[model samples]
Target: MTPLLVAVDVGTTSARAGVLTRDGAVLARAEAPIEIRREGAERAEHKSENIWASVCRAVAEAIAKAGADTETIVGIAFDATCSLVVRAKDGAPLAVGSDGDPDWDTIVWLDHRALAEAEEARATGHRVLDFAGGALSPEMEIPKLMWLKRNLPKTWQRAGYMFDLADFLSWKACGSLERSQSTLTSKWSFLAHEAEGWPADFLTAMGLEDLRERASLPRHASPIGHPLGTLTAKAARELGLPKTVIVGTGMVDAHAGALGVLGAFANQPETIDRHLGLIAGTSSAVTALATEPRPAPGVWGPYFGAVLPGIWLSEGGQSASGAALDHIIRVHSSGAAPTPLMHAEIINRITQLRSQCDDLAPRLHVLPDFHGNRSPFANPKALGVISGMSLDASFDGLCKLYWRGAVAIALGVRQILETLNARGYAIDTLHVTGGHTRNPLLMELYADATGCTVHELPDADAMLLGTAMAAATGAGLYPSLADAATAMRHASVTREPDRSRRALYDRDYAVFLKMHAHRAEIEAML
Candidate 1:
């Protein structure tokens, strides 16, 4: 019987599962939306039970569609948003909100409810803060835990375990509490690069020493193919699979994308050390693998054994790329109303508007930090700045603003790459995948701005492919991630920078830097 691998990817908006053959071809795929609830300022929550249900549904649908025998599916893996999942003993939900509802057990990654707490934590001048790009944002796990202690003290006291969303799913499926170094070290401030376990002082500072007391921290929390027990009979029934399926340690969604593609360069004689994986999504992340650890300030990294078994992974990105564009388009125009035309129609209208533009936001450049700056300058408090806007509020003008905003974001990616290049990393090529990768104009702009050859995976769903790669490793079809990526990953299209527009962008990017610097000066004066 031909072996199959099943991968469950739980993202910010939905849960998805894909079944892939040994060669990395997707045989079946399924998705189910996960609900989000917001109660104003920085509060975003998802029900843990609902997320699990969606995962089960997506997995069942994909397996049924593939028509593969349950016994033929050799392994399972997962990837999810770096959201924080808190639960009480016996796996009961513990509210992570101010309203004190036990059902709200999750603090969605996008939630900024812990902003003040994050600021406070950063103000302490903790040495570990340097690892998180000099300033830690509330989007990370530690700040959320601190916020829980400070604001939701009762729930904090009741909490039995804290899990990054991916680890939580792994725990749910195989009943192993081992957290992946990818999520814990990258987002939770766990010290994975060093021989030391999680920093005791850091945990003490966050008042999460109880976690250490329970000895939940793993000695070697790096990503490994753990025979993490079996799919619980209960979960197996829900997913319509056999209870004996093996599960493995999983990674964050974007990290999985990195794993899926980074290995594609195997045996090509190109040094994989300098290759950077640009995984763009609602947000953008830069994942790079290196032989020795190199810590780039304002970039989160030197994560040990996060992706490849022995290589260090450095990750950095804008908190809002796709999200930023959506925000700019909505706020600059007539609210979030869907255009009378379809999405393609609206995109065409925008394209036409851009053709009529004389200059790229001659008087207008947006900072694109509406959410928070996640790279190079990890300042969450940095408010967005839109320089040089007139009183003209026409919809067409608004569309132009949107175009400028997308370009500005592309420039931010450039700024990040510039930082990396200066730190002795050679980023020669860009590999992109996600919902945003479908936007050809945006892809071209990214290539032009960064001056790198941007390649898109042939498979529309690379994250699914990535998770399946992990499962394939567990199924013993491939000896390593590199081997699987070579057979499974291929680039269907490539976008090169347009030299004709290089001079224009070169000037515009300088202005982009000036606007941000000038805004900082302007704000300081106030």
Candidate 2:
């Protein structure tokens, strides 16, 4: 029988799984939705059990679809959002929020309930902050833990183990508490480069002195692709796989996508800095890898071995990209729901409008920070700004706003790219994957607005492909993660920037920056 691998990716709303061969060709793929309970604008929660169940379903369905026997699968790996999952000593769920329901045990990564805590962490100005873009983000684990401890004291007291969602999934699979270096270094403020990964002083300063003990975190983080042991009998039964299948250390979903696209250059580290990975979905993350640490303000990382071993990764992101576009459609009078068909209709209309007039909405401008700025500003408090709007509530008017909104999203990426370039990276190529790839308008803008060549991977899901590479390494199919990546890498369809539209976007970018200044000025007046 041919050896196969299962790669699971749990995102904000869904769990996806794929079955791939040793050479990285995906045989089958499946997805299952995981519920998110939203309490308010800033708070979101997930039941860890539900997420695991979703993963199991996805994996089982994927295996069945591929018509592969359970005995053929030799490896499994996971990638998830950096959500925090809490559990009691007896392995029961522990609530993470004000709600007393233990079932709501996971804090979603996009939860901003810890904004104050993040600001408090940023105020410390500790050396640890240097690795995290000189500011802490509420989206990271530390601040969220602080929020849990402060707001849910009873839950905090009951907490016995805490895990990054990816690590949590691994534990579920193999009953191991080992955490991934990718999750620790990138989100939990663990210094992968230091002798002591966890900074005690920083934890003490944040009143989380007992965090390591409370969370059951280990002194050392396992590198991505390290074998954590085979799945437990129970896990094997649940996932419809054999217990002999190895479970590999996982990573943040964006990092997994990074590996999928950029892993091809694992052996050619010298030119890796010229390429970047843009995992654009509900949000947008720009990942750049380099031989040495390249830290920049508002850009998270310089994380050692977060993705590839011995490589330093720098991540800059927009907190809302596709989400912002969805919000625009929802709020517009002519729009109903932001469904795929609706988005297609809007894009189709916008294209028609653009052909009629090169400048579709010349006056309309948007600063796409509706969910706060994550890159180049690091301001979670930052609010989106929009200028030039008329009382036109027609469908055409909605299309105009939507088109401009997409442009703003791309412009935000351009700003992040400029920041990365200034901070020792020579990135001129963007390897894009995820939901945004399906959006023609955003795909075009990603190249044209950023003046960078955008390479979209073929039909294979990059996130799953990246995790499959890790699984292939752990399964002993490859000597190293780099070898797995080099063997499994896929070719991409490239889009070059349209230079003729450069002057127009240049003007828009100027307006985008000016809008930022103006928003700041207006906020300062308050």
Candidate 3:
């Protein structure tokens, strides 16, 4: 029987699973929604059990759809958002939010409740920040932990184990306490290239001196594709797979997507910096890998071995992309739920309008920092700005705003690209995969606005494919992660930038930068 691998990806609102052959062709896929409990604007929580249950549902459904015998499923792996999962020593969930519900034990990655804590961490001036874009983000694990310790003292006292969401999933799979190098290095400030991954003095400075022991973190992190062990009987039964299935180390979701798209260039280390991976969905993450550490302020990384071993990875992104579009629709007078049909209609109208005119909303400008700016500026408190609005409350008005929003999103990617290039990367190609691929307007803008070749893998879900590559290595189907990647990677359809649109986008980009300065000036006065 041919060996198959199961890959699970847990995002903010759902868990997706895919069953793939050893060669990287996905045989089946499934999805299940997970709940997010939001308290006001700055806090979000997830139930660990609910997330695991969703994962189990998606995995079982995918295997059933694939019609593969349980015996043929030899490996499983996971990738998830960099949310923090807290638990008791006995492995039961512990509440992390104010609701006091034990089920809501995980902090969502976008939660900014730790903004103050993140600032405190930045104030320490520790060497750990050297790898972290010269500052700390509330989205990272340390600040979130600090927030929990300072605000929920009772929960902190009861905490015995903490894991990055991906590590938590791996532990649930095979009952292993091991953590992935990707998760630790990218989200938890673990310096993979150093003798000591975790700096004791730095944690001490941040008032997290006992964090390692409290979280049960291992001194050494397991590299990506390293097999933790076979699935536990309980996990195997729940997932409808055999206990012999190997459980591979997990990764952050964006990192997994990076591996999926950039894995083909793994052997071409000298020119890897010429390519970037844009895993854009609810948010947009631009991932670039280089042969050496190339640190840039406000760009997260130079994370060693976060994706490929011995390669440094840097990430910069907009905290809101698709989500910003959804918000624009939701707030508009002629809009509803921002469903697929609705978005398609808007895009169709915009396309028609652009055919007749040079631009749909030429005067309208948008700064899509509604959720906050994650890159270039690294300002989490930043607010979105929309210029040139009128009393137009018709459907066309909504379409105009939506079109400008998409343009802003693409412009943000261009800014991030410029920053990366300035810091030593020569990225000229963008390998894009995610929900944004479905939007025709965004797809066209990605290439034209950014002036880079955008390669879209239409046949593959890069996140799932990347996780499957890790599973293949863990199952011994390949000798190394790079080998698995090279074998299973998909061909791409390239979209070259339209040179005619260069002058238009250049003018808009100039306005985009000016809007940033104006927003800063207005905020300073307040």
TM-score: which candidate is best? 3
Kindly give the stretch of ten consecutive residues in candidate 1 with the minimal lDDT sum.
337-346
lDDT of 2 at 440: 96
lDDT (0 to 1) per candidate: 0.77, 0.92, 0.92
Which residue pairs clash in candidate 2? Answer: none
Error at 487, model 1, angstroms: 2.9
Error of 2 at 399 (Å): 2.3
Q: Is candidate 1 or candidate 3 better by TM-score?
A: 3
Candidate 3, residues 214-259, lDDT tens digits: the string is 8999999898999999999899888888889999997999999999
Each model's number of backbone clashes? 0, 0, 0
Model 2 over residues 61-164: C-alpha lDDT tens digits? Answer: 99899998889899999999999999998899998767588999999998989989988998989988889999888889999999888888888888889999
Clashing pairs in 3: none
The TM-score obtained by model 1 is 0.91
* All candidates: CA RMSD (Å): 2.7, 1.6, 1.5
Over the stretch 24-56, how does candidate 1's per-residue lDDT look in tens digits? 788899999998888887779998889999999
